[model samples]
Target: MTVYYCSASYYDNCDYWSTSNCTPPGTYCHRGACGTCDNSYYQCAWANLSGFPPENSIADTCGSSWLCNDKHAYDIPKFSCGTVLWVQDLCNDNGLNVTIADHGPYVCKCETNCNSVNLMRIIDLTEAAYIYLEGSFSRGHIPVMIQT
Candidate 1:
Protein backbone atom coordinates (compact mmCIF):
# COMPACT_ATOMS: atom_id res chain seq x y z
CA MET A 1 0.00 0.00 0.00
CA THR A 2 1.15 3.51 -0.70
CA VAL A 3 2.33 5.22 2.46
CA TYR A 4 3.03 8.84 3.15
CA TYR A 5 2.85 11.37 5.95
CA CYS A 6 1.17 14.67 5.21
CA SER A 7 -1.37 17.28 6.25
CA ALA A 8 -4.72 16.70 7.92
CA SER A 9 -8.10 18.46 7.91
CA TYR A 10 -11.51 17.93 9.48
CA TYR A 11 -15.13 17.44 8.30
CA ASP A 12 -18.49 16.17 9.49
CA ASN A 13 -20.82 13.83 7.61
CA CYS A 14 -23.64 16.37 7.78
CA ASP A 15 -22.63 17.98 4.49
CA TYR A 16 -23.59 15.75 1.58
CA TRP A 17 -26.04 15.39 -1.33
CA SER A 18 -28.37 12.51 -2.05
CA THR A 19 -27.48 10.10 -4.82
CA SER A 20 -31.11 9.03 -5.21
CA ASN A 21 -31.63 11.94 -7.57
CA CYS A 22 -28.42 11.25 -9.47
CA THR A 23 -29.35 10.33 -13.06
CA PRO A 24 -26.34 8.40 -14.31
CA PRO A 25 -25.43 4.95 -13.06
CA GLY A 26 -21.70 5.64 -12.75
CA THR A 27 -22.17 8.85 -10.80
CA TYR A 28 -23.02 9.81 -7.22
CA CYS A 29 -24.20 13.04 -5.65
CA HIS A 30 -22.02 15.11 -3.33
CA ARG A 31 -22.24 18.64 -2.06
CA GLY A 32 -25.25 19.04 -4.41
CA ALA A 33 -23.30 18.11 -7.56
CA CYS A 34 -23.26 14.94 -9.62
CA GLY A 35 -19.86 13.29 -10.02
CA THR A 36 -18.63 9.99 -11.39
CA CYS A 37 -17.73 7.12 -9.10
CA ASP A 38 -14.08 6.16 -9.14
CA ASN A 39 -14.93 2.48 -9.44
CA SER A 40 -17.58 -0.19 -9.04
CA TYR A 41 -17.38 0.27 -5.25
CA TYR A 42 -18.98 3.67 -5.84
CA GLN A 43 -15.93 5.63 -4.77
CA CYS A 44 -16.34 9.16 -6.09
CA ALA A 45 -13.74 11.09 -8.02
CA TRP A 46 -13.39 13.41 -5.05
CA ALA A 47 -12.71 10.35 -2.89
CA ASN A 48 -16.15 10.29 -1.24
CA LEU A 49 -18.03 6.99 -1.28
CA SER A 50 -21.64 5.76 -1.27
CA GLY A 51 -23.20 3.72 1.54
CA PHE A 52 -25.15 5.23 4.42
CA PRO A 53 -28.49 4.31 5.91
CA PRO A 54 -31.66 6.41 5.81
CA GLU A 55 -30.52 8.17 2.67
CA ASN A 56 -28.72 4.92 1.93
CA SER A 57 -27.78 6.58 -1.33
CA ILE A 58 -24.33 8.07 -0.60
CA ALA A 59 -22.16 9.54 2.11
CA ASP A 60 -18.65 10.59 3.02
CA THR A 61 -18.12 7.02 4.33
CA CYS A 62 -16.80 5.96 7.75
CA GLY A 63 -14.47 3.50 9.48
CA SER A 64 -16.96 2.48 12.12
CA SER A 65 -20.34 3.45 13.52
CA TRP A 66 -18.60 5.28 16.36
CA LEU A 67 -16.46 7.30 13.98
CA CYS A 68 -19.67 8.65 12.44
CA ASN A 69 -20.34 10.53 15.67
CA ASP A 70 -20.26 13.91 13.96
CA LYS A 71 -17.27 14.73 16.14
CA HIS A 72 -14.95 11.88 15.18
CA ALA A 73 -15.02 11.82 11.40
CA TYR A 74 -11.77 11.08 9.57
CA ASP A 75 -11.84 11.43 5.78
CA ILE A 76 -9.38 8.84 4.58
CA PRO A 77 -10.02 6.68 1.50
CA LYS A 78 -12.39 3.72 1.70
CA PHE A 79 -9.45 1.38 1.23
CA SER A 80 -8.18 2.57 4.61
CA CYS A 81 -11.54 2.35 6.31
CA GLY A 82 -11.68 0.35 9.52
CA THR A 83 -7.94 0.56 9.81
CA VAL A 84 -6.19 1.90 12.90
CA LEU A 85 -3.79 4.68 12.07
CA TRP A 86 -1.25 6.64 14.04
CA VAL A 87 -1.06 10.39 13.44
CA GLN A 88 1.47 12.78 14.88
CA ASP A 89 1.37 16.52 14.50
CA LEU A 90 4.58 17.75 12.95
CA CYS A 91 4.20 21.18 14.50
CA ASN A 92 3.90 20.20 18.16
CA ASP A 93 4.62 16.49 18.33
CA ASN A 94 1.07 15.85 19.57
CA GLY A 95 -0.33 12.56 18.31
CA LEU A 96 -3.26 10.20 18.53
CA ASN A 97 -4.73 7.02 17.13
CA VAL A 98 -7.49 7.43 14.55
CA THR A 99 -9.58 5.40 12.22
CA ILE A 100 -10.10 6.10 8.55
CA ALA A 101 -13.64 7.40 8.63
CA ASP A 102 -14.29 9.10 5.32
CA HIS A 103 -12.64 9.82 1.95
CA GLY A 104 -11.40 13.19 0.68
CA PRO A 105 -8.93 16.03 0.47
CA TYR A 106 -10.85 16.74 -2.73
CA VAL A 107 -7.45 17.80 -4.14
CA CYS A 108 -8.52 20.70 -6.31
CA LYS A 109 -10.87 22.05 -3.70
CA CYS A 110 -8.31 21.91 -0.91
CA GLU A 111 -5.67 23.49 -3.14
CA THR A 112 -2.45 24.23 -1.25
CA ASN A 113 -3.89 23.15 2.06
CA CYS A 114 -4.29 19.56 0.91
CA ASN A 115 -1.28 19.41 -1.34
CA SER A 116 1.99 21.25 -1.15
CA VAL A 117 5.77 20.83 -1.07
CA ASN A 118 5.55 19.62 2.53
CA LEU A 119 2.04 18.27 2.42
CA MET A 120 1.27 15.13 0.43
CA ARG A 121 -1.97 13.56 1.75
CA ILE A 122 -4.89 15.08 3.61
CA ILE A 123 -6.43 13.22 6.54
CA ASP A 124 -9.50 15.01 7.80
CA LEU A 125 -10.38 14.64 11.47
CA THR A 126 -13.64 15.15 13.29
CA GLU A 127 -14.15 17.76 16.00
CA ALA A 128 -13.54 15.19 18.68
CA ALA A 129 -10.36 13.92 17.12
CA TYR A 130 -9.13 17.43 16.47
CA ILE A 131 -9.79 18.44 20.02
CA TYR A 132 -8.11 15.31 21.27
CA LEU A 133 -5.05 16.31 19.29
CA GLU A 134 -5.26 19.81 20.77
CA GLY A 135 -5.98 21.38 17.42
CA SER A 136 -7.92 24.54 16.73
CA PHE A 137 -10.74 24.32 14.26
CA SER A 138 -9.97 27.81 12.99
CA ARG A 139 -6.52 26.62 11.94
CA GLY A 140 -8.19 24.68 9.06
CA HIS A 141 -5.25 22.39 8.37
CA ILE A 142 -2.42 20.85 10.37
CA PRO A 143 0.69 18.97 9.35
CA VAL A 144 0.65 15.34 10.44
CA MET A 145 2.31 11.97 9.96
CA ILE A 146 -0.12 9.14 9.21
CA GLN A 147 0.86 5.47 9.35
CA THR A 148 -1.10 2.26 9.18
Candidate 2:
Protein backbone atom coordinates (compact mmCIF):
# COMPACT_ATOMS: atom_id res chain seq x y z
CA MET A 1 0.00 0.00 0.00
CA THR A 2 1.20 3.49 -0.83
CA VAL A 3 1.67 5.74 2.18
CA TYR A 4 0.29 9.27 2.10
CA TYR A 5 1.44 11.84 4.63
CA CYS A 6 -0.19 15.09 5.67
CA SER A 7 1.73 18.09 6.96
CA ALA A 8 -1.07 19.68 8.96
CA SER A 9 -1.36 16.74 11.33
CA TYR A 10 0.48 13.68 12.53
CA TYR A 11 1.21 11.37 9.63
CA ASP A 12 -1.78 9.36 8.44
CA ASN A 13 -2.31 6.42 6.13
CA CYS A 14 -4.09 6.86 2.78
CA ASP A 15 -4.28 5.00 -0.46
CA TYR A 16 -5.14 5.48 -4.14
CA TRP A 17 -7.02 8.47 -5.57
CA SER A 18 -10.03 9.29 -7.65
CA THR A 19 -10.87 12.34 -9.70
CA SER A 20 -13.86 14.37 -8.57
CA ASN A 21 -14.75 14.35 -4.90
CA CYS A 22 -12.00 11.86 -4.31
CA THR A 23 -9.78 11.80 -1.25
CA PRO A 24 -7.61 9.22 0.34
CA PRO A 25 -9.45 6.87 2.69
CA GLY A 26 -9.54 7.82 6.39
CA THR A 27 -8.98 11.47 5.45
CA TYR A 28 -11.56 14.21 5.35
CA CYS A 29 -11.90 16.47 2.29
CA HIS A 30 -8.97 16.20 -0.06
CA ARG A 31 -6.72 19.09 0.95
CA GLY A 32 -6.03 19.89 -2.70
CA ALA A 33 -2.48 18.74 -2.04
CA CYS A 34 -0.63 16.58 0.44
CA GLY A 35 3.01 16.83 1.39
CA THR A 36 5.36 14.65 3.33
CA CYS A 37 5.26 14.79 7.11
CA ASP A 38 7.97 16.51 9.11
CA ASN A 39 8.17 13.62 11.52
CA SER A 40 7.11 10.59 9.57
CA TYR A 41 9.77 8.60 11.29
CA TYR A 42 11.01 9.37 14.79
CA GLN A 43 14.33 7.61 14.34
CA CYS A 44 16.94 7.31 11.63
CA ALA A 45 20.44 5.87 11.93
CA TRP A 46 23.46 5.56 9.71
CA ALA A 47 23.81 2.11 8.21
CA ASN A 48 27.23 0.49 8.46
CA LEU A 49 26.82 -2.86 6.87
CA SER A 50 30.46 -3.01 5.90
CA GLY A 51 31.39 -3.38 9.53
CA PHE A 52 29.51 -6.65 9.75
CA PRO A 53 30.75 -10.05 8.69
CA PRO A 54 30.22 -11.04 5.04
CA GLU A 55 27.39 -13.33 6.08
CA ASN A 56 25.54 -10.43 7.65
CA SER A 57 26.17 -7.79 5.02
CA ILE A 58 23.33 -5.77 3.50
CA ALA A 59 25.03 -6.09 0.15
CA ASP A 60 23.43 -9.49 -0.04
CA THR A 61 20.12 -7.71 -0.56
CA CYS A 62 21.39 -5.43 -3.29
CA GLY A 63 24.77 -5.75 -4.92
CA SER A 64 25.74 -2.13 -4.45
CA SER A 65 29.45 -2.08 -3.73
CA TRP A 66 29.37 1.69 -3.20
CA LEU A 67 27.03 1.58 -0.18
CA CYS A 68 30.03 2.18 2.09
CA ASN A 69 31.47 4.93 -0.09
CA ASP A 70 28.33 6.58 -1.38
CA LYS A 71 27.12 9.44 0.73
CA HIS A 72 23.62 9.42 -0.77
CA ALA A 73 22.31 5.96 -0.11
CA TYR A 74 19.23 4.41 1.44
CA ASP A 75 17.97 1.23 3.06
CA ILE A 76 14.23 1.29 3.50
CA PRO A 77 11.51 -1.31 3.93
CA LYS A 78 8.93 -2.22 1.25
CA PHE A 79 10.63 -0.36 -1.58
CA SER A 80 12.20 -2.58 -4.21
CA CYS A 81 15.91 -2.64 -4.92
CA GLY A 82 17.17 0.21 -7.13
CA THR A 83 14.10 2.29 -6.32
CA VAL A 84 15.03 5.94 -6.00
CA LEU A 85 13.54 8.22 -3.39
CA TRP A 86 13.52 11.94 -2.85
CA VAL A 87 14.16 12.52 0.85
CA GLN A 88 14.36 15.63 2.96
CA ASP A 89 15.56 16.07 6.49
CA LEU A 90 13.07 18.01 8.58
CA CYS A 91 15.66 19.03 11.16
CA ASN A 92 18.14 20.59 8.70
CA ASP A 93 15.95 21.09 5.64
CA ASN A 94 18.43 19.20 3.50
CA GLY A 95 17.16 17.23 0.51
CA LEU A 96 18.65 14.20 -1.22
CA ASN A 97 17.67 11.92 -4.04
CA VAL A 98 19.02 8.44 -3.74
CA THR A 99 18.49 4.84 -4.73
CA ILE A 100 17.65 2.03 -2.33
CA ALA A 101 20.82 0.04 -1.80
CA ASP A 102 19.65 -2.18 1.01
CA HIS A 103 16.53 -3.44 2.71
CA GLY A 104 16.57 -3.63 6.48
CA PRO A 105 16.10 -2.75 10.11
CA TYR A 106 13.10 -5.10 9.79
CA VAL A 107 13.23 -5.34 13.55
CA CYS A 108 12.75 -2.18 15.50
CA LYS A 109 15.14 -2.02 18.43
CA CYS A 110 12.81 -1.23 21.29
CA GLU A 111 15.38 -1.80 23.98
CA THR A 112 15.18 1.78 25.16
CA ASN A 113 11.55 2.63 24.52
CA CYS A 114 9.13 -0.12 23.76
CA ASN A 115 6.14 2.00 24.57
CA SER A 116 6.10 3.54 21.10
CA VAL A 117 7.72 0.92 18.98
CA ASN A 118 5.14 1.35 16.23
CA LEU A 119 6.23 4.92 15.62
CA MET A 120 9.68 3.88 14.48
CA ARG A 121 10.32 4.20 10.74
CA ILE A 122 13.15 1.67 10.67
CA ILE A 123 15.05 3.68 8.06
CA ASP A 124 18.78 3.30 7.66
CA LEU A 125 20.97 5.75 5.81
CA THR A 126 24.59 5.80 4.84
CA GLU A 127 26.97 7.77 7.03
CA ALA A 128 27.36 10.39 4.36
CA ALA A 129 23.62 10.68 3.89
CA TYR A 130 23.10 11.13 7.60
CA ILE A 131 25.83 13.74 7.89
CA TYR A 132 24.63 15.60 4.83
CA LEU A 133 21.28 15.92 6.58
CA GLU A 134 23.12 17.49 9.54
CA GLY A 135 22.74 14.49 11.83
CA SER A 136 25.26 13.97 14.62
CA PHE A 137 26.87 10.57 14.44
CA SER A 138 27.36 10.57 18.19
CA ARG A 139 23.62 10.85 18.66
CA GLY A 140 23.17 7.70 16.56
CA HIS A 141 19.67 8.62 15.44
CA ILE A 142 17.56 11.60 14.39
CA PRO A 143 14.03 12.33 13.34
CA VAL A 144 13.61 12.62 9.57
CA MET A 145 11.01 13.17 6.87
CA ILE A 146 10.97 11.02 3.79
CA GLN A 147 9.54 12.62 0.67
CA THR A 148 7.40 10.11 -1.13
Candidate 2 global CA lDDT score: 0.37
| Candidate 2 structure quality by residue, lDDT tens digits, 1-148 | 3331111111122112322454455343422111221122222221222233334433343344333223112333334444455656554567675444443443323121112122233456554555666545555554444554
Residue 66's lDDT in candidate 1: 26
Task: Return the lDDT, model 1, position 15.
Answer: 31
State the lDDT at 99 in candidate 1: 53
lDDT agreement with native, every candidate: 0.46, 0.37
Return the clash pairs for model 1, or none: none
Candidate 1 deviates by what RMSD? 13.5
Q: 1-148, model 1: which lDDT tens digit per residue? A: 5344566666543233323555664244443222221121212121333342312211323333422213222434344345556777676778776655455544422223323334533456655676566546777777666665
Q: Which stretches of model 1 miss by more than 4 angstroms?
A: 1-3, 14-78, 109-117
